[model samples]
Every structure is written in C-alpha cells, then in structure tokens.
Target: MIEGLEPWAQQGLGAATGLAIGLLVGLERGFKLRRQKEGKRVAGVRTFSLLGLGAGLAGVVAETQPIAAAVILLAMLGYLAIAYAPRLTSGGDATSPVAAAVTVVAAFLAGLGNVGLAGAAAAILVFILALKDEIHQFVDRLEERDIHAIARYGIIALAVLPFLPNEEMGPYGAWNPTKLWWVVIIVTGFSFAGYVANRLFGARHGTIATALIGGAYSSTAVTQSLAQRLGQTKGGGAEPAGIALASAVMYLRVIVLVAILANRILLPFVILLAPALIVAWVAGWWLYRQAEPSDAPAPPGNPIALVPALGFVVFIAIAAVAARWAQGQFGEQGIAILLFLMGSMDVDASIVTAGGLPPDLIGAELAAIAIGGTIIANMAVKIGVTLAYARRNGWSAALALLASTLVLAGSIAVAWLRL
Candidate 1:
C-alpha cells in the first residue's frame, strides 16, 4: 500500500493524520462545551475541523512556497486572538481560545511529517483536560518538600548527569563517572516512583500497599520501618505480612535489574531464584490474609537526598574497584567472596559491579553466583531487621523470610554443583 503512493499522496496521508488528531481533540472540546449556550461556546467541532484543514493545506503549500505557510499560521493566530478578544471583554472564559490555539499548532506539526509527536501531544492534552479534578486534587496534596524533591531530581538527572565524564577512571578502570551516575539515576528514579505511589495510595490502601510499593526503593528499609511500626502496636499480623511481601518484592526487583543489565545471566538467575520468589509471594499473601487491616504511613523524607546519592556513588565505586582488584589478585574465587561480603550492606552495588564485569575476566555463570550470594546476604539482613524491631510479631515474618531464602540458597547450591 505504501509503495503505490506518489509524493503528493504521501503528503496527503500525513495531512490526513493531522486532520484526524484535530477532529479527535475537537470532538472532546465540543462535548465539553455541549451544555453551554451556542454563542457562549468559543470554538466547536466545525471550527476546529476547519482550522486543522487550513493548517494542513498550508503545509502542502509550504513545499513550494514557505512564505505562504508563514502567512497562514499568522492569520490563524490573528483570527483566534480577534475572536477571543470580544469574549474576554464580555467576561467569557479564556480556556477555549487557548485550547484552539494549541490545536492549530499541533495540527500544523502533524502535517509537517511529525504525526507521531502531534498525535501523542494531542492525546496527552486531552487526557490532562479530562483529569482536571484529579490533577487539582494531586496538586492540593503536594507538600513543599515534594516540590523540592522534584527539583532535586531534575538537577541530578538533567543538570549534573550530562556534565559527568563518560570515560573510565580510577583503579582497574573500575570507575566511570557517567555509568555510576546512571546507576544513581535508576535507584533514585525507582525510589521517587515509590514515593509517589505511597503518597497517592498508602493511607487508603494500608500496610500491604506501602510494603509492596516501598520494596522497589529499599526492601530492607521497608522491613526495618514496618518492624519498628509493629513494635509500637499491640500484636496484629500486619507487620509480618508487610515484611514478607516487601522481601518477596525485592527478589522480583533483582530479577528485573539482572534482566536489564546482565540479560545473558538473567535466564539462569531466574531459573534458580523464581521458585523462591513465588513461594515468598504466596506465603506473604497468606500472611496478609491472616492480618487485621492496618494503615502504614508513608516513609518520611525525600527519596533522592544528595547525601544518599553521594554515598551510593562512593559505595559503587568502592565495590567496582574491589571486585576488579579481587579478580585480578585471586581470580573468580576472590570476586565471589567479595560479592558475599558486599551483599550484607548493598546488594545493588554488587549486582551492578558483577553485571559490569568484563566477560574475559569473569564469565556469566560466576557473575550469577556472585549475584546469588548477594541475594542470600541481603535476605539475611532483612531477617535480622525483622527480629530486631518487630519483636512481638517478628517470629512469623522472620520464619517466612527464612523459608524463602533457604529455597533460593538451595537452588543456588544445585546450580553451583552443576557448574
């Protein structure tokens, strides 16, 4: 079908895409203004459709006469301004006129071979308009700290990251500033997303929701926090359930990170660990079923604090250098041992370093083992937290977590024996 189209026909198809977008947007606007008196509605389906067609025709004219396209755009803007001026003078709303202006611009871009962007923007605009109430509610809910958190994220991702040197530096070529910052970005982004989820749903959804969402940021931290909360309460089962679920989610998080950064090893990693993950999830769900419903407050503080980001940079740099040095000095065994130790403090850093290992130095199987060690060690930390803080209700949660860890350890053992 595409092959048969001539140049003019191809341009026509582009224009048609633009026209469709405009019509879709216009349909929504018309529906929105349907209750308004006819004269009070600033623009409607017919007006919008004509504007889109005019923009598209101008695009066609631009191929031969760019000046004509410019004139057309200016004329459309002037017409919209003139139409809206009288309405504003008479105390009418400005929303319809602003929307009309934006629609025309989107239509013009769509006709200029930017159909994808124009369509996406139009769809997004419509969605935003539709969600007016929800948007206002969300804004009302935001605290000053939340705005500061967003600003910090923008600085980290947009301002600072781009300026970092991409080349490898430090000992054993272990530290690349760009790569380290990217890891920071991934962690911060995950935490920020979890923070948003917690804000939006935590109070209404209770402990299970908090734990499940919070796991993406820091499962160990979630476990610790839940345990502390449980300590203060009279014995209810919510703490155990939250802890188990969060710990289970951590395994899934690991699986995802491995799949992204070490895909070649993901198959073996999943095969060995997935059964444990399933068992943990089922056990957690059962615990949740047993628990009395209880709300868990969102974790306090900004998710992407500068101190933590800097700390992560230091931690990862050290882990990477340690892993490289260990491999150089003691071969694969050294790297494996280091990974086990590192796992107790930060499994993520171990996983990142292991995934980044040069293939010639450490094979995929060995890297997977290193990752498995970190998983086991990280689970141990969570188990310790459960025991330390959730004193009254800790046993059940700790037992459930231990059961999952043992399954994972058994799988790793079997895989190691085969290797």
Candidate 2:
C-alpha cells in the first residue's frame, strides 16, 4: 500500500487542497466584487486557483534561492496591474487590491499547512470573505460613540496605564497608581460583563443579578427600580420574593467587594457566614418556589459607566492612604474604625484591601467583621427603602419581601448552629 503511493502523491495532494481552497475563496471574492454594484470582473474561481498554485510553486522554488520568492511576488503584482489597467481609471480605493492579494496568499498558505494551523486558515478566510457585505454594512452602521469607546479603551491600556507612577503617595502612603488602576480595571471590567449578562440572561435568572449590578452602580437606583416595578404590577407571592432576592444579593455584593479589598476580614466572614449565606440563599430559592411563578419583571438597573470608574479609582486610592495611616496611628483598632465606616458607604473596598494584610500590620479579622456588620446594616436600609416604596407605590409586596428577609436572617443565624 505504501509502495503504490508515489513521491509525487504528496505534492499532488497539496496542489489539490490548494486548488479547492482557492476556488472557494475566489468565488467569495467574486461575490464581494458584484456587491460593489460593479459589472463582473476577470478574477474569479479559476483565476484565484491558478494564482494560488503559481504562488505555491514559487514558494517551493524560493527554498533554493531566498530572493527568488520576492522576485516572483513582485512579478505577480505586475501581472495584477496589467490585468486591471483599464479598470484602474474607475477603480477607486474601494477596489481594495490589498484585500484580494491577502485572500490569495491565505488560500495558498492553507495548502502548505498540513501540520500546524495551516489549511484551517484558508477555510476561515473563505468564511470571512463571504461576510464582506455584512462586514461592510456593520462598519457603516457603527456610530461615533462606538468608535469613541474602542479608542478610549485603547488609550487607557496603551497610553495611561503604561505611564502611571508606581510610587506610594499621601498620608496612609500605601497607594500605588498602577495598583489602584488595576482595582479600577477590575471594577470597570464588570460593567461590560454585567451588561452582557443582563442582555443575554434577562430577568429570568431573578432580580439578583440586577441587585448586584445595581449595588455596583447605585443601590439607591436599585431601590427606585424595585419600587417602580412594584407600582406597575399587582402584589403577588413573587413580588415579595423579588425584594428578598435583591436584598440577599446585597450581601453577596458586599462580600465580593470585601474579597477583593480586605481578604483577612473576608476570610472569617466567609468562614462564619458561608453556611448561613448558603442556607439563606437556598431558603430564599425555596421561598421563591413556594410563591406562584409570575414572569419576573425586567430588572431595573444600569452598569457603572466611565465617570464612575474614575471616581472608584480615586476613592480606592484615598482608602489605601487611610489604611496606611490607620496601620501606624490606629494600630489594630484603626482597621476596625476604617472598615466600620467604609464598609457601609461601600463595603467591598475596605474589606478587599485588608486581605493578606498582616495581623500586626492591620486587623484582618476586624475588617471582615466590619464588612458583615455593614451588610447587616444595609439590610435594614433596604427594608426601610422597600417599605417606603411600598407605601408610595401601594404595593404591600415589599412588606412580605421584608418579612421574608427577616426570616432568612433568622435562618442564617440558625444555619450557623453547628458551625
């Protein structure tokens, strides 16, 4: 069987593959030309296939003399010029010869790629070429705002991030610009994530995702959203369940924040509250089931925007400085004070910042306690918000939601029984 396959067979196989790919890509290019509302052009399937074949042979010859390939490539360019000489008068920049040349090269490379990522590229190129109309249409539709977003991200990563000073600054003296920027990056990166999640997943996943993102943007906004939603719909089992769900997510949000900023304190809270939180959430889920299902309303919230990202970075920088000061002046007590105060305003920053900070350097445990206490404190605020909104909206559902949360809190305390 091996003897029947001659040496020429391998070369023939490559040629065959190259010709097939070239034919497909060439057809796609022809369609692209037709879409320009131009008459038929000379270059089509056969033309492209031959171009690939000739290029492939030239590449083989260049193995003996390196300069030979460049000579062939330049010669091919001349042939292309001759072919389009008459059309050149009308062909404006839209003709895009570079794109055509690249298509041919890609098809040729696909035949060569028997081992590494070779022929697959040709297939991908063919598909991409097929989408030329759609691609062009997409580009045409992108507004100035879209371009600005892309450019803004580029400037941040390429220009601003690279030049920032790494040195500590101010009273607490722990702040580093890069580190703070990275914190901003973490928080800001989630905006896109949350946006995509909310768009793709919708409210069927429950209002929890809404609450988390809302907490990031503004918990006050989330309260307003919930209140408005309550006003629109008749109070039902699912209504109170939604409120409890949002409030539960609040704890999760604070916990996530603390995990990033103050891990030492977060670790204990995780240890203490892990079971309680799990039980509370699980019970909430069960409570959710007990209420008859209504299509959950679309969550009312928005992701954090660019200004918020900058504001958060500045706040984190300030917190880092405050933490450094407390380390020296407040000793262990400084952490408790900082965490207790900051955990409520925005708990995650203080809590996450404390992680891995030494007990002697900073009180990690106290920081964790502060985060938990803040979450608990926030619960009370949510209840007040819910009640007030209920009164204004005339949806008694908030009362049930608040009652469910109280029950959940009790269950959490109970869940910690063995722990």
Clashes of each: 0, 14
lDDT of 2 by residue, 113-209 (tens): 3512335666777767677777786677555655665565555545577788888766646667887776666555544455434434445455555
Against the true structure, candidate 1 reaches a TM-score of 0.92
Tens-place lDDT per residue, model 1, 200-253, is 777578888888888877788889888888877776758799999998888888
* Cα lDDT listed for each candidate: 0.82, 0.58
Candidate 1: which stretches are off by over 4 Å? Answer: 1-4, 85-98
Would you give me the overall lDDT of model 1?
Answer: 0.82
Best by TM-score: 1
Instruction: Give the TM-scores of the predictions, in the order they appear.
Output: 0.92, 0.61
Give the lowest summed-lDDT range of ten residues in model 1. 295-304
For candidate 2, the lDDT comes to 0.58
